[model samples]
Target: MESVKLFGTWFSPYSRRVEMALKLKGVEYEYIEEDLKNKSPDLLKYNPVHKKVPLLIHNGKPISESLLILEYIDETWPGPAILPSDPYERSMARFWAKFLDEKCPPAMTRACMRTGEEQEKAYEEAIEVLTFLENELIGKKFFGGDTIGLVDITANLIAHWHRFFEEFSEIMQPPLITKEKFPNICEWVNDYTNCSFVQENLPEKDKLAQLYKARIQAAKAATQ
Candidate 1:
């Protein structure tokens, strides 16, 4: 097998998604922590367009974007597939995953930076997107049904970094990740957190929270 190297930052939820997929697929790879401010020449050459973290290099070929890299990994390894086999179900999983990638993330990032009126608007948007997740979980244990699958991997943010948003964002006031507020999600957390791959790879919550807080502040400052 050719060498696989993951170029990522420590605190990016996007990078974590790829890492989780790689773990679930049982693929071994070198983990390279990148300095985003001063990206490695290899990273820039590999992903010149976005020039962002979470770039996966395989056999000297580079894959950019977390979701794309995930699909690539699954396609190549062909074990513990994150995506579903059934056509319709596969489409549904892709739909939800794309929704998270396109909508939920930007909404959360906006909520993190907004204050007063802007924050209120962002709060409404965030809740609206979160409602889809709640509704999607209605009859299914996981987004892909009984076992964790594609959309489940995409939605991994709720597992670890959710608290940082709830704690730091004054305007986006949904306590969705809390046990009392979301019993099923909370219940799911017990199994999700204990899963061997997830448990082993997850970063410490307190440390991650501090990093998340700092990133939010930095993003806010850069935009202002």
Candidate 2:
């Protein structure tokens, strides 16, 4: 077995996605936490292109980007398949992953970090994105079906981190994913978080709250 090392941070949703993929695949790896404010030499050397966390170093070779790393992990380890075998389904999974990656962060950032009209616009956009996901989640316990797979891994941000941000950030509006409004998403969140692997690797809520609080403060400071 080749040695695997993961460079990541505790509160990063991208890093957590990679961590969940590794844990679900039952891959044992050495986890090195990176300080985004002061990145380490190894992280810089390995992922010079993006210099981002969640870089997977396998047998001394580095893989960057969380989504690509998840795909690589699924391919490298056959123990538990994260992606569907069917070609069309696989494509759909990839499509949604890409959609969320491109659209989610900005909308969520707008909703949580900005205020007044900027926040209202972001809130609406964020709701649209979540609405699309809520529709996709209808009649499915997990985005990848019964078991948590590639789509679920990618969607983990919606299930966990997004909820946490809404909860902790005073700038964010009221909860958008309540059971009455988005039953499927709420159910999926419960199922995803209840999974033993997810429970074990999920970032502590209190720590994440503190981190996000500092971020909100920093963003406010930048404008004033």
Off by over 4 Å in 1: 170-176, 179-181, 216-224
Q: lDDT scores for all predictions?
A: 0.80, 0.87
Worst 10 residues of 2 by lDDT: 167-176
lDDT of 1 by residue, 91-129 (tens): 887898999889887786677667789977876787788
lDDT for position 202 in model 1: 75
Candidate 1 local lDDT, residue 133: 79
lDDT of 2: 0.87
* Residue 90 lDDT, candidate 2, scale 0-100: 94
